[model samples]
Target chain A: MFAIEANGQKIEAKKGETILQTLTRAGINVPTICHMEGLLPSGTCRMCVVEVEGFGGLVPSCSHPVAEGMKIRTNTPEVMQTRKTIIDLLLSNHPDDCLYCARNGNCDLAKLAADNGVRDRTFHGERTHRPKDISSPAIIRDPDKCILCGKCVRMCEEIQGVSAIDFVNRGSKAYVGTAFNEGLNVSSCISCGQCILVCPTAALSEHKYIDEVLQALADPEMMVVVQHAPAVSVSIAEEFGFKPGTDFDGKMVAALRRVGFDRVFDTSFAADLTIMEEGSELVHRVQNNGPLPMFTSCSPGWVKFVEQFYPEFLPNVSTCKSPQQMMGAVIKSFFAEKENLDPKKIVSVSIMPCTAKKFECGRPEMGRDFVPDVDFVLTTRELAELFRITGVNPAAIEPEPPDNPFGERSSAGKLFGASGGVMEAAIRSAYFLLTGEELKEYKIQDLRGMKGSKELRVKIGDLEVGAAVVSSLGQARKLMDEIKAGRSDIHFIEVMTCPGGCINGGGQPIGADQEAIKARMNALYQIDRDDRLRVSHKNEWVQRLYTEFLGKPLGHKSHELLHTHYEKREVLL
Target chain B: MPTVKSVETILKEHPNAGRDHLIPILQEVQESEGFLSQESITKVGRALNLPSSKIFGVATFFNMFRFQPKGKYHVMVCRGTACHVKGSGKSLDMVTKTLKIQPGETSRDKLFSLEIVACMGACGLAPVVNINGQFYAKISPMKLQRIIEECREKEQTHANA
Candidate 1:
C-alpha cells in the first residue's frame, strides 16, 4: 500500500486499485452511476470525477488508477458543480414522470439528484421520444427514460452472457436496443431480469400483474390463490423496513389473506414435490443407463438458456416442471377437485423471486385443455407494492400458517432458495432411495454458500454418486463446454440462472448488496437447520399426496402433472 | 470486374479470426454486398463468436456502414461549411421533395438514394453534389432537379431498350 492525500486526509491506497475503490475502502462517499462492482469500469458517466493535484481536468475516480503522493479532492466546489451538471444534463433528456414510474421511490437517478441538491432543471435539450418495448411477458424496456449508462447492457452481456440488448447508434442519437431494434420477445433474452436488477433508472422493470391480480381478487366468480416462492419470504422483509434476511413467511401469508386471496400456499411445498420427482428420475436414469450428467430444470431462465444456446443438451435436462408450475398445476387440478370448485374459476397466481417464472408459467406444455395452469405471476417487488397498495403491513400483522394440502414443506424444500441448495436436498433423499438409510449429515457442506460452481461426491451403499451445482448462466456455459469436451465424472448437475440463486434473483429487491444476498442465503440455511422435516420423502403431505392422488413418483399420473419437455427455440441475437 | 464473394465464403476466409477482426470482416462483407444485411450480420456474429447486438452496435457507431441496399443512382450532397454557406440546404430540400425520400433512404423505384455527407473537400466548388462518382460543382436546386430527372429518363430509356 502507498499513501495518497484525499480531501485533506492521508489514506493508504492499494497499488493496482482504482481511486474509487480506495475511496470506497476508506469509507469516503464518491457518487457513481455506471460503475458496477465486479464489472470493468466503462467510465461513461462522469459522476465520480475528482480534482487531482496535477491533472489538467477532473479525473474519473472510478477508472483512474491510484498513484502514490497524489492529492485528490473529491468534494471540491468545482467537482460538486461538475457532478451536478452531469445530473442536470441527464435529467434534461429524462422523462419527468417519476410519480407514475414503477421505480418511483427506488430510483438511483432521483436519489442522486436529491443528494446533489439539484432543485431545478438547469439545462434544456430535446428529450428522447422512443416508444416503450412491452412485447415480452416478463420485462419492459422504456427507452425514453434510459440515460445510456449501459449498466443494463453490461449486466445482460458481461454477467449473464446473454447479449440480448446493446448500445445502438452513436453519440446523442444512441440508445440501448435489441438486434434491429426489434421486440425483446423475438430476441435472445431469456427474461432473467438481471438487466432490470442493475438498471439505475426506470428504464427496465418487470411487467406487472398487480392490477390483474386485484381484479381477480375483487371478482366473486374468481377464486384467487397465491403461492410465494421460498426466497421471497426471506428477501421481502427488506422492503418493509425489517432486516434483509428476516423471514416473514407467516406474516406474508397473513397479509395475502388480508389482500383478499382465497388461499395462500407455499411454493416450497411444490419444491418438495419437485425433489421427489427429480431425485427418482436421477436414480432411474443412473440404474437404467439413461442420460448421464442430467441438468436441473427448476430455473426457467436456465431452461430457456439451454433451449436457445444448447439445444443438443435438451434431452440431458430433467423433465420435472419448476416448483412454481408444479404448485400451479396441483392447485388448478387436485386442489380445485378437493374443494369442489371449478378449475376455470380458479386464478392460480404465483409470487416468485424470478422474472423468468413469468415466462415459464406461460409455456404451452405447462398446462392442459386451453386454460393455463398458472394465471399470473408477480415478482417479490410487486408483492411488496401490492401490500403497500392495500395498506397491509406484513411486519405489523400477526403471523399465521399457510392453507392446508399444499402448505407443509420440508426444510430441504426451503433450502431451494440458495445457490447449491437443490443438489444438497437431492443428495439427502437420493441416498435414502438407493440405500434405505439417511446420510450421516443432512447438510452437504460442499453444496452450500454462493460459489458460482460447486462439486461433491456422495457414497450411497457401494455406489458413489457425483453431483455438481452451478448458478449464473455464464458459469453454466463453461461447465457445459467441459461436459461437451467429454468430462464424464458428474452424474447430476444443478443450474440456477441468477448469480446466487433465487435469493439474489432478477426480481428480488433492486438495491440489495452482496452482504444482503449472503444474509438471505444464511437465513435459508438457518431455517433448514431449525426445522425437523429435513428431507422431501419425509414430508407427510408429499407422501399423503402420492397415496391419495398421484399413486407414486414417476407414475403415469405424476408424469402427466409434474413432468414436461423442452424443445429447441429460435431467437434473434 | 471482380467476383463478389458470399457472406459464408468471406467468413470462411477468416476461419481463425477473433474480435479484433470484426471491422475488417464487416468492411469486406459490405464492399461485396453494397450494404450489411441482417443475414450477413448474423453470420458475421457467429463467425466471430460475438453476439448480434454487439456486432450491430459496433457496426452502427461508424458512419460508413449502411443497413439498406444502395439504389442505382446513389446521390451524395456535401453539407460542409463552404457548401452550407452557399445554400446547399435548399439543394438538399429540392432533392428530398423531387425524390420523396429523406437522407439515408432509397427511392421507391430503386433508382435514387440520398446521403448528406459532412465534407467532400471541394470548397473551391461550393455547394457540390455527387451522383454515381460524378461530382457537380456550384449546384443549385434547379440543377439538382434536372440531374435527378436526367437519371430517371436514362433509367426509362435503358428499360425500354
Candidate 2:
C-alpha cells in the first residue's frame, strides 16, 4: 500500500492505484467514463480533472496518482462549472434521439446528463453529420450518438488491445472512429466487441443478426442451427436477469430449442477444435520456424490491431480460424455433408458476446465453398431481443442438452472464452505434441492472467518457446513497439482484443461495471481449474474430429476449414 | 537533426522533462526546426532510452504535432464554435483559395503555413486568425488578402534586416 494525502485527506492506497482510484476509495467521485478501475486509465476523456494544491492547474484525476500531503478539492465551483461545460460540449453534437435509442433506459451518459441537471444544447450549430456504419454482421455505429468520451476507444485500445478505434482529429472536430469513418467491415478491426461493452451510449452497438435468425426460423426451408460460445453460458443468463457467472448452459440450450432452432450447438466443440489446430500450429511454427510469434487470431480485435498498427508482424498471427469462423466453415462443409443439407440452406447462427463477430462473418476471406461459415452473428443483448421477439421466457423454459458430435466439449474448450485460456489450452496440447510425452508441467505460468504486458520463454525439448500475452491494445502497442525495435524475443504470442477475453466481449450485457466483469472472469478461471479434462487433446470429441474429419493441423482440410488470410484496405465512410 | 539535438539538450537542462517531456520535446523541436523531423524522433529516443519508432509513433499519433517543415510565417485560422458559426469555414476556404494550399499545408514559396485550430480558447473574438502568434480578430474573406499582403511585406523586411 502507498501512503498519500489528497486535499488534506490522509489516505492509504495501493501502490499502483491511480489518483482516481485512491480518491474514489476515499469516497470522492470523479467524473470519468474511460477510467474503469480494472481497465487501463485511458486519460482520453479529460473530464475527471482536479486542482492539485501544488500543481498549477487542474489535472486529470483518473490517471494522476496522489502524492504525500497533496491537497484535492471535490466541489470547487470552478471544477463543477468546468465539468458541466464539458458535458454540455459533449451533448452539443450528440443525438437527441435518446427516446428511440437502444440504450435509452440504461445509458450512463443519459443518466449523467440528468444527474448534472443539464437541460440544453448550449452550442447550436450545423452538426457534423456522419452516416451510421451498419456494414458489419454484429456491431453498429451511430456516430451521431457518440460523446467522444473515449470509453469505446479505451475499450478497444486498452481492454481489447485491438486499437481498432482512435481519435481522428484535434479538439471539437476530433471524432473517435476507424481511419476515415470506414465501416468496421472494411477496417482492420477484430470482432471482439469490447468497444461496444464500455461505450457510454448507443454510439457503438452489436449488429442484430437476431432478425436474420428470426427470418430463417420463419422460413421452413431454413434449418437454423444455433451455436453458443463457451463464454455465453456464464454471461447469457444476465440478459434474463440472472446473476453473472451463472451456468445457464442448460437454460441457453432450452431457450434456443424453444426459440425454434433446429439444433442448439455448443461453440465449445469448435473451441476444442481450435485448441487442436492452433495448438498444433504453435508446435509446427516452433519446430519449423514458420513464424516466430504465432499470434492467436481468435480475437478479431487483436487481428485487426496487428493488421493496422503492426502489419510487419502479420505473419506472426496464427492462420487458424476463430471458433465461430471454424464452426461456420465446418457447419457449411462437414455439418452440411453429414446432415445431407445444402451448404447454402443451413443457416449457421452464432450467439456471441462480441460485436466484432458481425464484421468477422462478413469478411470476404471468411467464405469457404462460396458460403460464409457463420451466416449470422448475434450478441447476448440481440439474443435477448430475439427472446422478446419469440415471446420465450428464459426463466420458464425447461433446461435441455445440445445436439451430438459438436456438443461434446471438454472444460479446456470451455475455458477458451477467457483471457490466458487460449494460451493455456494451446500449451496443454502443444507441449504433448512437441515432446511426445505427457506435460506434467501443464501450466504455462507466464501466459496466465492480466497485466499491462506479459512475456515469457519456456523450454519445450530442444526448442525454447517464447510467448507473450497482453489484454489491452495500449499494452499491445508497447509490446509491438518493442517487437518493431527488435527488443522482443517472443515466438508464440496470444493476444485477446478484449481484456478478460471473450467473456467480456464488446457486445455482452450492458452496464457491466468493473467488478461485474472481474467477477465473470474469476468464475471462468475457476471453471477452468475445476474441470478434470483441462487439456484440448484430452477432449474426446476433438481427438475424434482429428481422426474422422481433419487429418492434422495446417493440413489441407485444416487450411480449408480453419485458416484464413487478411487484407489491408484504406477505411472510408 | 542538429537543431533537434540542440533543442533536446536544452530540454535536458530544464527542470520538468521527466513527466511532461513528450509534449515539451515536441514543442521545442517544432520551435527550433519549424516542425518535428524524423531526426528529432531518433534523438529523443536515444536521449530517453525509448524506442525511436515509439517516439515517431507518438508524434504521428497526436494531432498537435506537425510532421513536415512549415513556412517561416505560420497563419492559423480559428475554427471554434463561435468562429464556425460566424463562417470560419468560408474564411478558411478563401485563405485556401488565395494561398493555393489547403489548411495544414505550407506554401511552396516557404512564406506561409495555413492551419485551422478549434476555438484557440478565445470565443469573444469570434472569428480569429493568428499570423506568427499575432492575433487577427473578426477576419472575413475580404480582410484575409490584406493580412497576407502585410505578412509578405513583414517577411521581406525581416529578411532584408
Best by TM-score: 1
Estimate how well candidate 2 is docked, as a DockQ score.
0.06
Q: Candidate 2 lDDT, tens digit per residue, A436-498?
A: 877786555666554546777767778777767777566677777877788657877777766
B1-161 in candidate 1: lDDT tens per residue? 34699999988888799999999999989899988988999889988889998999998888778787889999999999999999999999999988999887788888888888989988899899999899999999998899889988988899999
Q: List runs of model 1 lying over 4 Å from the truth.
A: B93-102, B107-111, B141-161
Worst 10 residues of 1 chain A by lDDT: A120-129
After aligning candidate 2 to the native by TM-score, how far in Å is the CA of A476 from where it should be?
A: 3.9
**Which candidate ranks first by DockQ, i.e. highest?**
1
Q: TM-scores, in order shown?
A: 0.96, 0.72
